[model samples]
Target: MRAFDPFGWLEKYFSANTLHLLIRAVAVVVILAFLIHRISLYSRYLFKPLWAAETLIFVIFLISYIIRINPADRSRGVREILIPLAGAMLPFALIFSPSQNLITGQTNYAYIVFIWMTVSTALTVWGLWTLRRSFSITVEARELVTGGPYRFIRHPVYLGEMLSAAAVTIFRFSPVNVLILFLFVAIQLFRSKMEEEKLGHVLPGYIDFAAKAFWFWPGPPKHQR
Candidate 1:
């Protein structure tokens, strides 16, 4: 049996490198379809401040998947694969539960929400631009990206995601949404641990980078010893 590298767990069953890639293309197609639906739905709100910036983040995501280079290695186990899939799909699940407003939905709350989204979207796009071809949804060892927002945070993308996701969760507050948000953040943090473990094993410099960089919080970039 051949492994589908892109889907990660499928690699448990499939075997060829090219087969991995072809399946990866299929995975990208699925992501592209989902994101396109999101982009269209959100574009209707383009008149909102920096709304297009948020939309472009999706564009970057699709492009990153399309242009990403092959990983040096990736974990093929089902556990490693499913953790990320859960994080990716968690938000979509929120569509089912009715959205309960967290606050009075005042103009002040609106401004605060928009600000979080704007900042988070900027951070995400910055990390994405830096990560670009090195990006992967699954736990894969690729090039060590140590520049840009990565200088300060070990996982700027995850932080940005956390913030943006938090903002969304706040707006769509509900018991189910809260649980989903908690799991999403917890999974992201755990995924960071998995990534660091993989990178420390596979890339020589990452261990050193991890030491100086904050996990998700902002901090000064790594400096000379």
Candidate 2:
């Protein structure tokens, strides 16, 4: 008995390489469009000392994601390569793994994944809009923002990203992706600490804000009583 292949129809008309390239091109176009929209929304207020860091981080994220989604680079050996290159790239890797194809035939699973993606996207957008002009890619205190989602967690943007990474990993169910997610969590925690330190140094009210709000969750920091 021949095994059933849901995506076999795609291969009948398009070569695997061509299909992969098409998928990647679509991904790139979508990402670029979103980034262009975001930059336009924030363009007027983006002129700051820290905008360079923001731009660099965005570029690094885009490049890393594009690399990770390449079909040619999805080999087991490439995982070894990615581990070393997985500093800022780990989050993108977790959120967008090349091994996970976009050809799921299970409607229930697709619906669940869609719901998760929707929630994560909403959270990310809310976090971005809340931060507004104060959004910096690196740990810098332009203004002490403690409203909207920040009222609960100091790093709502990271929290949103974490939710997104979790959703993607859950949808794909890969051990390597779980490991990448853990690494992303560690990086975000370290970044959050650095941000808090910078804000505490620059803003006199940050210490009090830290006492009231959690770093990345609902509760206060572990060191707090």
Candidate 3:
């Protein structure tokens, strides 16, 4: 009787492509589970006027990650689509490729990456929890939430998201990923400015809040007349 060869079976079935697909599948499942968990937790607050916008934002964030994990082909030649898509997807592709060389021997590097991911995740969760029902996708003043993370930064959520995104990019360590991170930062800054504009216009105390809170860092308060 022949002995069972588990290693051979695994090597045969779990090729590079198969492993990449498996990773992508696991990522999708995890993301969906997280989203469902958050939705369930916030179910009571879903009836707010800005619920649609908040839901849209969540959907967009999820979709962006899904696309990043399993990106489309770049041969389609759409420059606008390819740039961001390539930036997000190429890192994973390289990481999973059989010919690629990863720094597996560096234990400290791995530890740092783990720490970065943990901190980023905590920041993002803190921002979300602090926002609670006040969270809105658009720049509408659902409420001027000044407690928790908002006390230090006017846009703590953006800061958290950007930090998480940066950590992911750093883990991958690619120029394209850096470009994507920069682009994301620019978008978040613009969004923050727009939100401030709307809040300042609608909420009477927003000016005071802005004057007291930094945009996304711990610094001197904004100058107000």
Better of 2 and 3 by lDDT: 2
For residues 58-88, could you state the per-residue lDDT of candidate 2 as single tens digits?
A: 4444553455332311212222223223544
Deviation from native of the Cα of residue 178 in model 2, angstroms: 1.5
Name the best candidate (by TM-score). Answer: 1
Candidate 2 vs 3: which has more TM-score: 2
lDDT per residue as tens, model 1, 1-225: 224334445556765576657856886787788777766676456236557666667778778877877788665664467778789778677657654454434667767777887888789889988998888776778888999999988999889888888877776777878888889999988888777767777776776777788775332223321
lDDT of each: 0.74, 0.57, 0.54
TM-scores of the models, in the given order? 0.81, 0.55, 0.54
lDDT of 3 by residue, 37-149 (tens): 65665555423323333444455455544443222111112222233344334323433322112433566765565566556556655676666555434333556678887
Q: Output the number of the lDDT-best candidate.
A: 1
Angstrom error of the Cα, residue 157, model 1: value is 1.0
Q: How does model 2 fare in lDDT?
A: 0.57
Badly placed stretches (over 4 Å) of model 3 are: 1-104, 216-225
| lDDT of candidate model 3 versus the reference | 0.54
